[model samples]
Target: MSTEAVTVPPVRTPTSRGSDFAELSRRIKAAGLLERQPRYYLLRATALGGVTAATVAAFVMLGNSWWQLVVAVVLAALSGQLALIAHDLAHRQIFRTRRPSQACGLVVGNLLLGMSYGWWMDKHTRHHANPNHEELDPDVAPDIIVWSQRQARSSRGIARRLAPLQGYLFLPLLTFEGLNLHASAVRAVARPGLKQRRIEAVLLVGHAAVYISALLLVLSPAKALAFAVVHKALWGGYLGAIFAPNHKGMPTLTGNDRPDFLRRQVLTSRNVTGGRVVDVALGGLNHQIEHHLFPSMATPALRQARPIVKDYCREVGVDYAEASLVSSYAQALRHLHHVGAPLRDAA
Candidate 1:
């Protein structure tokens, strides 16, 4: 048959179903989980805080030697884990009111992790508002790395060269992510216009003083430097590994394609399915779809909320993507590779 005369299949537009957000909200409310369970979260916060403090104390008390590197690495992991607690606090998941939650966020974010709660909230709120929207979502905004096909293909010079190999370089690049976050947080606080900027900056400065003083006082200069490097890099890599799988492989939206809240969050988020071990490690982020839907829910509650959200999605014809840890990573890698293919071909 001639090409012009042949019939071609028409593209099927996704049916515009009415918003399920209100329904999901009702289900979640009926589940009676939106209320902050102070006991559970407070206990979790205390345990994480105590463990992180003890680890730091151990690091300071220990001698400056090869073993200090191991301590530094451990401390970094703890700090990364502590960040998860800070994340929940920032979302007001543990507290009924904003002030107490903000207080907890300051303690965990500034004192414990040496990061800025204000800066994180400024960025993270936008992410929740627009999870995968290219312009609106800070998570997918242009960074040191290119994450989309358009970005990769349009990149120039050195970035263009690196775009093609991003998937392979993803982990190695993540090793530097800890330092990147620190710099970004510092920069954010350094700028004017943020609420209570001076106080936040002071907290950050205090953290820097204490952190550096303890390390330098307890260890030789070379050892201290080594410790800092190892700790920060490991913390970055650990966090990257856990978080990248949540939405990196999922759909990316443009500003105009505004889906309703429930559909937007569920379609863009991917869940990592394992057991409680993975759950704990990811700080309940493994159930990303559920967590995005019910961000204020306590971490433990996310797992409980998963079935409800999944069942709702199935009934509503919404996509709920989930996979094992390894599988999710593979999917993300494939996505990266696909996005960067044009750059690879050009090179």
Candidate 2:
């Protein structure tokens, strides 16, 4: 089959037009998949804290040695992990109440990662409400990269020029995603409407102050710069890789093309198939369909929920897209290339 044909998975139209989502929700609730996993989260948070402390200790002990670059890599990975935890916190996966979830989200996102929790929460909430939507989903909105042909056709200047090769450029561009995220957070807080803007700004400033100070204090200026570059680049790439596969290659819904809830989530999202290590690395995000369906489901329970979701999707005749880690990226890239075809021909 042609790569274009394989880019999007075949979605079976629902055989019965019954209340599919309600039935699936009933099954999932009966399975107790929506229950909070406080104990699991407690253990996860404690472990992450201990590792982060050890990484910091290693950085301090390593002193002015160039070997601290290794520490930078570790720190970058830890930052990604922290961001994943913040994602869960934003979804209220670990906490039952908004107050506790927001509190933890601020600490993990703004205070540690220099990202605005409020900004991310608002954006992610919209994404869950309408995944892969050409107009409504902020994720697919025309940005540095265009996801739809309509956006591609309207692109100007650098974005227009880059559209044709965007498939290949996507991963490379993510190297700067960390910096972009920090910049976005600052811009978000600067705006008037974001909730707790002042608090977010303060915490973001604190993160920057402490992060840069520690780097300069521990290493020479040149080494510190290199360390920062490597750390941020890898952190962005890691986080981007985790999220890119979820919906990029899937069918995008345009105006008035809305599917029912179950079909919408299952058909648009792609699941990554892997073992325990991938689960930990991606922080249960590999089960993208399950995660979207049950946003507040705990990380540990996502794996268990996956089969149930897949089975139900099959019974309802909706496609449940699944791919290996590598293939998922390929599928996404193909879609990018396909979307940019018009731009390429015009060039």
Candidate 3:
């Protein structure tokens, strides 16, 4: 067997057929789960928000100084979950129009993750548009590690070294406003066409005012710090893990080329868990494959939509890739090992 003869495996990992996709997509579309029931979204948002707020409140109330650390960690996890909700609402067209989504996403995104809704939506939209295409994907900024195999094999490679820094250290620590935050910030300042700077100013200033007021008016810095720390650790780590797993390992290519949207998203991204839990907690992240297929669909709707799409894919015999969080992480590490400029004709 020649080295050239060792064929790379097809991207799909889960064995799905056309029937699965048909039922999932058709069922999802038929369900008319557009823009999720507002009550559902509101209830979910409130519940998650309460859980997060309560956790921090306890830390401050209990007077356990170190509980601040615990609070921060818990907040981080909760923040990640909350952010997912905002993410769903941002994309879910169930809202009367983009305005409502903007309103909701802005308020929710800031409170949950301290990121600008519009900024995130713009970058994310591009990420979806380009997938692994190196040229067009605006989300593939300098701070992010590009994926490629040749880069992995190179000794003491710059790209490989950066992966650990970005994936593990900076990513988990910084949350949304990590080093990449500056690039977007700079972009917003330079272009200012997308309302990025103004939006960011609001978030930052708003955060400062609230935090300062808390410290001055009510909770002490110690208490506030406790909440902030825990929230950052858990939510930051969770968000980094979810986002990094999908694209890190799959494949990298040039702008001239493109992957079939369904095919590439399926290959590059993997669904973590499934069912309503995902639809709710993960904000359709569980329906990651579906969301990639039709990002315009609201995330909450992905739940009903997943089965529809799954059935459709099954009937079509498209191999689907589904991984447990643990498996996904293992693959993410491997994916990080490869990142480079895609050569032309290297599909």
Looking at model 3, report the run of 10 residues with the lowest lDDT sum: 1-10
Candidate 3, residues 11-33: lDDT per residue as tens digits? 34434534333444545666775
State the lDDT of candidate 2 residue by residue for 1-347, as single tens digits. Answer: 23211233444443464477877888899999899888998899999999999999999999999898899899999999999999999998888899989998999999999999999999999999988887889998888898877789998888888899999999999899999999999899988999998899999999999999999898999999999999999999999999999999888877876766776787788999999999999999999999998899999889999889888878766778899999999999998988899988987
> Which regions in candidate 3 have their CA more than 4 angstroms from the true location?
1-28, 31-35, 141-144, 150-160, 163-191, 196-200, 212-229, 274-281, 298-300, 338-347
For candidate 1, list the clashing residue pairs, or say none: none
lDDT of 1 by residue, 69-108 (tens): 9898788778878899889888888776889888878877
> What's the TM-score of every candidate structure?
0.92, 0.95, 0.74
lDDT of 3 at 281: 49
Summing lDDT over every window of 10 consecutive residues in candidate 2, give the lowest-scoring window: 1-10
> Judged by lDDT, which candidate is best?
2
- The TM-score leader among the candidates is 2
Score residue 237 of candidate 2 by CA lDDT: 96
Error of 2 at 129 (Å): 0.6
lDDT of 3 at 112: 38
Stretches off by above 4 angstroms in model 1 are 1-18
lDDT of each: 0.81, 0.88, 0.57
State the lDDT at 169 in candidate 3: 44
lDDT of 3 at 115: 62
